[model samples]
Target: MAGDNVDGVSTRESLKSALKEIVDRTASVELSGYRDSAEMSGIPESSSKLAAQETSGISGQSDKELKPSPLSGTEMASTTATSSKSKSKSSTATTQQSITSRVETPSDADVRLSSAISGLQDYFRKPCFVHSRLDDAVDVSSVITAMSPDNFSHLSHSSLVRTATGVRELAKRIGQATIKVNLRSILIVTKARDNSLIRLTRELARWLILTRKVNVYVDAKLRLSKRFDADHLLDPSDHELDSCLRFWTPELTSMMPDLFDLVLTLGGDGTVLYTSWLFQHIVPPILAFSLGSLGFLTNFPFQDYEKTLNRVFDDGINVNLRMRFTCTIYKDGHQTETFEVINEIVIDRGPSPWISMLELYGNGHLLTVVQADGLILSTPTGSTAYSLSAGGSLVHPEIPAISVTPICPHTLSFRPMLLPDSMLLKVCVPRGARNTAWASFDGRHRVELRSNDYVTVTASQYPFPTVTASTMDYIESVSRTLKWNVREQQKPFSEDSDGSTTPVNDDEGADDDQLDDDWDIDDSAFFSSSSSSTALSGFNSAPQSAVTTGSSSPLHRDFLTLDGK
Candidate 1:
């Protein structure tokens, strides 16, 4: 009966029955597509083919020579491992977290290195594309070596090695390493009310990190809450108040001395001054990146963070060692306290209705009784800052001088004077003064000075080091940053030309001749007049009757008359 049924079925019906059976058999196969294996292996089929093509391209290279492409996550990790292995080859490399190989012969190596670096410099001089990757290619060793030792010393060995490696690696990867420097840390400090400046500082920090991968640290307590929530921050929680407390916890507080290499200060000159005051005792170098409206102390531009930072790391820029003032406050003839200032130590009226009385003395000699709103005692470096506003002369940073400027003096006769750096200045508020004065160090940390309180100020033993580009000079920085008489055209006298010297006026020469002639005439007339007077006196004194007799003789009479007159 089964055989008859099979024979009765048409060929198409038989084919359909077989296809249905096949479809039923593949139900498990369709279920397998939904299984974990298919879902878990999420890579597209096209990607495998693309990877295969890439591998095939480098198939001819030896296994050792053919590095895995860093684009792939696994391959990148593998490459990093390989790099770590390469770094471990040297004993000196073990201490260093990053890979750095020292040249066996630095003197000989520098020649070849300098040539390569010079080529890179020429390449960077032109307009070029700027990306994070491009910045890694610039070789700044030549520029570093060419800079002054004082400037170059500011850059650590690690920084120099990293910069050189980044430059060289970039050049090898691409055609050139684009120069994009960054100021890594910017500290913005303002009063509790300065929200606008705080916002600007945050914006600057965001721009730097996004465009240049620079790190920014804000030290202002008022903006700490907002900065902790900033979106661009990688580890917002890391900078939380709790984290900061944890960092300075009992265990780590002792180690705080060794934690930070440098500190960066943002905001105005006041912020920099405040930061310097806080760290002066610790004595770490500061990189002050200005974010304020007026930046006399801050030489760095907010926009050129990348270039500035790169110059710091790569070329070993110079640092101006700014002098600081150390003040010792005395109360009732006892040493009460000591403070340091980067700018000026200002003694002013503290909420008093009347002007403060300040008796100033320089090296034990009484300078003057300064009756004014305040007095500014500043280092040469601070001359352009608060002192300048107080009618002080702008002294160069390199000059060893101190500026004593009176602020809003009651008398017009009071003018600023530059004193020798070696002198110790004593400022006192005498007994029964109309109003008491207050002393502040760098616009921070104020101390009240009652009647009979004395404040003594002198140059500090230590100096603050400030890093700058290799091409940066103190005078040039003042001119460019401060916009102090930056004239484009040179005066004729200033021009470098081989020309005839200006002639002296004939009147001047005649005056000199007349002076000589007058001296000679005076000397001759003096001797002649003395001799004639003696002779006439003797002739007239011979006798009153002799004088009347000499009147008949012209020579004797004239001589007698000249002697009498």
Candidate 2:
């Protein structure tokens, strides 16, 4: 109905264009008779079907061929021209809508990228988990090596500064590496005769057997011998353990340290001390749970055992090196006995009515004659223990130093002394004394020192590498466990003559000033040759090394005055 003669154009394109223009012209003119004829034009099948339904009501010319009509050429040309103008307007509207929609709406990827950019600064603003005060105050110079996570072979420098994701990455790396360390055993040492300890041990043992793939060991007597009250912990036979649990008795004591990778202590600080005693030579990492009364060394909490174990197995633990004392008793020039102590070696008058007289010598140099109730030769780790009770300075364990505190000295001038870790100290019960003195290691291994007997204290080659709990380090542990520096209440400020309120801080101010002056003095002079040097063994006379360890990180060194430098 609409195809006119076309000389050069494609038949499909020309026919469709002419049909579209004829349909528009006829529909607008209400020429209903010709509508059916236009619908039958040689257009595509889809367009022809749509036109047939839209013009169904039109009369005449149904299914007619698309040919030049009988109308005059002038009228046909004018109608086709009008239809082309309207067609162009409709096509332009459709194209504009398509372009506008594409530009206004964004893709999912684009939206996500925008969100990430907006939140990037906030992601970096969040602080990483750390003990700010402890990390700041720590003197890392004394630390021979800080046990942290892995280091890439070529990027060893960046490994020292832990990143935000360092812990997680390290845990993954350590777990992969430690997969081969099968039979990683743990030794549990608890306080004796306490129902709580028995219950804890039983629970821990059960957890170990059911959940972990490691071996558990306890004291043989705790599981074998018939104890007074706690029988439940021992009721389960060795067979029930599936060979995953073992025991260490008196006979096997020498090999306990070598067999285990870690020690779990379920008592107070005393439990830690006892555990340290068991491993006389080389102490394993101890995870000391704080159940005892005084828990200075027992930093871990019983409640956090599961989390602590997870970290331990993944090598996420901080191991602090604790210096130990190697004490040897020399009786009549013969080495009579030898032992190791995690804390101090005490020489006191046991059950004697008179004050004990002890001759102190450092590296074969006569130091002084001490007339006191007792003398405490403590390692830096022990400074917070027996030495602190005897008015000794709180020494940082990593400083590589030893403390000597006189207990109830006869004269007020007798003060505590702090010496380098390399120094060899000798405490002698002079040739003739009023009463025999007593010597003890870490408050255990009691021995009597007769006249002319001597006890030598030196830093042990074996150092105790204690596992630090996630909660605290040495400084925080001391503050929390020993309640050090904790005042009951603060006194109100007093008004000065200048109408300014001043804090009523005690003699701590003067002490701070003296400490600064002491940090400046050459401590090498203390070990120098001198004739009239008085023996000092008290907190006030503690060595400068104890107060301000010289070695530290570059940042801390800026604010800290170490070794008078």
Candidate 3:
């Protein structure tokens, strides 16, 4: 390895020397163009001839050194003709012709320059593509020259054209802006400690790296796991796997928000929730596989990962920005800890055998005194989760609303209420409260709220973007998992000749099938497209920083936006 490094250093040094020489020569040519153009503007024949002779000398030297000279044949001929014309006549026409020649053969000079660069590249046996990149970087002037003054903007070459009154016409032409990105790096969050999952991870990693040319990242634990890299799991000849595999820890994800293009979850909804946990600030678009049971969030089937991934990679995906709550716990009037809660935050009495007296305030105004067992503050995405079980409404994921459900209110009249996402609500354990309240963020991170300590809950700017199988995947999940509005099939009846109605006999297994088919139709009747239209356009995070205060950390700067525009 040391010898290899030494040889690499030598090659790089040689390449650098060659590049420096070319740069010096190009600089001399550019300088000659500017200085000679000014000098030959109105100078006599002898002066123009001197400039031409100097240019010819540079070209002649290039011809001897490199096969492809920087100056093309047309350039050389034009130089010679200009010199001859200058020697014969120092008239306005000759000067005009000389300037014209320079402009006319610029394209040829560029071609020759590229050809020369290519020839230089051939001399090196480097494995990387850096040599070819230097060709373009070194020839930046060529690009500026190509964009002539006449071409201000090329509408004909533009992707978006406003034909109709709306942007949909352009959307059809350009496709979804969210899906227009190059899906390069992917972080796969696999279910931990499962050999079968490990095998699937390896299989997916191989396909992503080899087939899609993507950088696959798994949890750091899988990098050297005995089961993950077991001999039986990998082929004996697959020595290249070690180098290709990549691992990402929680710390890295927190630091680098744009680390992954997309995150794939290989488990139930818990794994999907875990992904939300991984990136506290900015989260990439998540594509979850339903490997475990009760796949509310993980709708996509694991068996069809290839098809799903192909569609996501090639076409695009319909992403629903699930609303989240940014719960900030404040102790002694100073910010203690902040968490991005996907599901809900439970503020309940933990081990304390007393009623949890909590004060709820919205927008700095006292809303109510939660004289209950506890309060469940949840986003619309968590409505079907713990919030629903607590008698909260099953709000859709796209709804910009928060569910405030009392776990078990002291008063029977106290019911679950839906609040606008814009409301900045604060739940505080009163200093004179009976017992201290415990807070659980998304079913994890159990924290205690003491007297005078308050927790602020608001609609998070950073939302969890989950890829859906369809635009109505959330509805389908509700119907399938929660069995929403599901009931026994009504028997079909027909009027007889005697005016008596009788039940129509049908196959035993057919009623369930008919009812299943009817549910989709019934659902379409209730929920219209406008009702569930995405409030935010799509995922836009890690690009710009969010609203930051004095206490905000650098890692938590990016405020995830889903502006449809």
Candidate 4:
């Protein structure tokens, strides 16, 4: 307990100091950078970017505002910023006049700077939980409107450069403890024709209904199951438990996301995929259990169902907003269909003997002419699916990039490449191609791309969120399921048992003496003179932003040491 307190304080102070520095530097830069630009542009781009990107999760637009919640300290602070910002917007008409009337002074800037600093300090000081209440989503950028270049009200000089999907991540980054979320309704997805799983599903459903007092929904077909009715005594006539239970179908596509707070999967990865298929648009957060064949996506264990659900409804989940690709097919320049795929999309000559003569276009410019059997466009989540078998590198989910692996290329020099998620990829079945090619979304919904037809693939705003036990579970799955790099112990030799000569390492070279001198060189002794103190101090100073991110903070160090996701 004592050690944890010290570590928590260190993490908090480190994060606070780092964030303050960024705020200080950003305020200075944006004030000087956008002073003149604001005059020409009416309002600074930095200030409007936040409003522009506040698209709701249900709208399939922006990633912000994934959920809605109660009136709490965090939300209150955000609300204050937004309301004041709104009032500031109404007075923008006089911005030019105010700017032209007088020049900004150091004192004025200092006042604005203090306002920004104090606002952040107050918000940061609040305890994470107050009676198990929380803001809908984790949003670090909510209270960032205090620093203004002025003459413009309710305007920020620039926006934060963070792409995080939840406010919990921001809180975690800033050294906050686990907080709770409001979960009222849950929908459980189960595999078909599996009696054991159906029984497990019923068990979970009843618990959620009686113990949790939350509305529970199950597979639409289960309403007809005599076993299901007999278990709850709803088969004969009306019952009180029947009121708590509901049946879910794909027809609830438009309104299901808004009604259901969370989704639970009982079978396995396929059950998870079926959930994805059920909701092609805005998807609710999915918490999966490992009951299927391969448990890659199903990271949670069924044994811990009771504990996991309690924790989930009590303390919120740190959702990984996994990116999905929006693949839209266009024929003769007219949009025909659009489907989102969590895994990679394959475009190859289907059931034909001809090589797929496809042309690749990146962001509307011709990048290459594909002469391979097919091209694999995979998200990092799906990198291990079809991408790995097709020789694509295993990419981490955090990396904002896509895998482009050419499947069975005819050219000897063709190799797999990774493209940025921002790149708009268009693969066309050339009008003069010998035959039509096919495309599939997550190994389902096969669509034929005829001659002169092309499909545009880009990162979708709607990301699939799955509840994970911990980030390490992903790496552990690689070892446990895939058995990555598994091998038998190699033979060991002992000098006493077998007469042998010592072998030198292959890395050693003839110029070992020079390397030794370099390694043994002294720094403080060499820079002992007063004239070299500046250089010494400069050399000793390390950057705050490191490869692990926020290196100056103890929180980041702890994160790295724990192998955090």
Q: Work out the TM-score per prediction.
A: 0.46, 0.53, 0.58, 0.58
| Top-scoring candidate (lDDT) | 3
The positional error of residue 305 in candidate 3, measured at the CA in angstroms, is: 1.0
What tens-digit string does per-residue lDDT give for candidate 2 at 440-540?
A: 88888799989899999888876776766533477787787777779878788766565545555576665475553233333434543344344244434
lDDT by residue (1-565, candidate 1, tens digit) is 0111221222222222222322222222332211111122232333323323333333433445333221233333444556667766655445343322222223322233234323323322322112212223343445556455776678889877886797566434432212222233333334234665656555555554555453344442433356434443445554532222101111111112112334556566666666665554433445667666666667776667667655655653344556788899999899998886778899999899898788999999988999999999998878877898778998877666889999999997998888888999999998979988999987778999988999999987656656544334556657766788866663332211333223233345544744532222123322343578786667667765544544576657777876885
Cα lDDT of model 4 by residue, 1-565, tens digit: 0111221122222222233323332333332211212223233334222212221111342323222232233443454455555678746545544443333322332233334434433432332122112333433234433323452364344432232233336544422334334565688899877887877888888888878776687875776676666245333353555567766655443322434668898887778877877766667678999999988888888999999988987777766667788899998889988887888789988999989899999999998999989999999988888889988898877677889999999988888888999899999998799999999988898998898999999998667877667867678888888898899765453232234423334566778846633323334444444567676676467454432346667658766877855
| Cα distance off (Å), candidate 3, residue 392 | 0.8
lDDT of 3 by residue, 70-182 (tens): 34445555666666776886787877776677656654434434444344333222211111222322453464464555553553534224322233443232222233335
Identify the superior model by lDDT, candidate 2 or candidate 4. 4
Stretches of candidate 2 exceeding 4 Å from the true structure: 1-183, 224-241, 470-472, 488-565
Which has the better lDDT: candidate 1, or candidate 2?
A: 2
What C-alpha lDDT values do all the predictions have? Answer: 0.55, 0.62, 0.66, 0.64
Worst 10 residues of 3 by lDDT: 1-10
Cα displacement (Å) at residue 193, model 3:
3.9
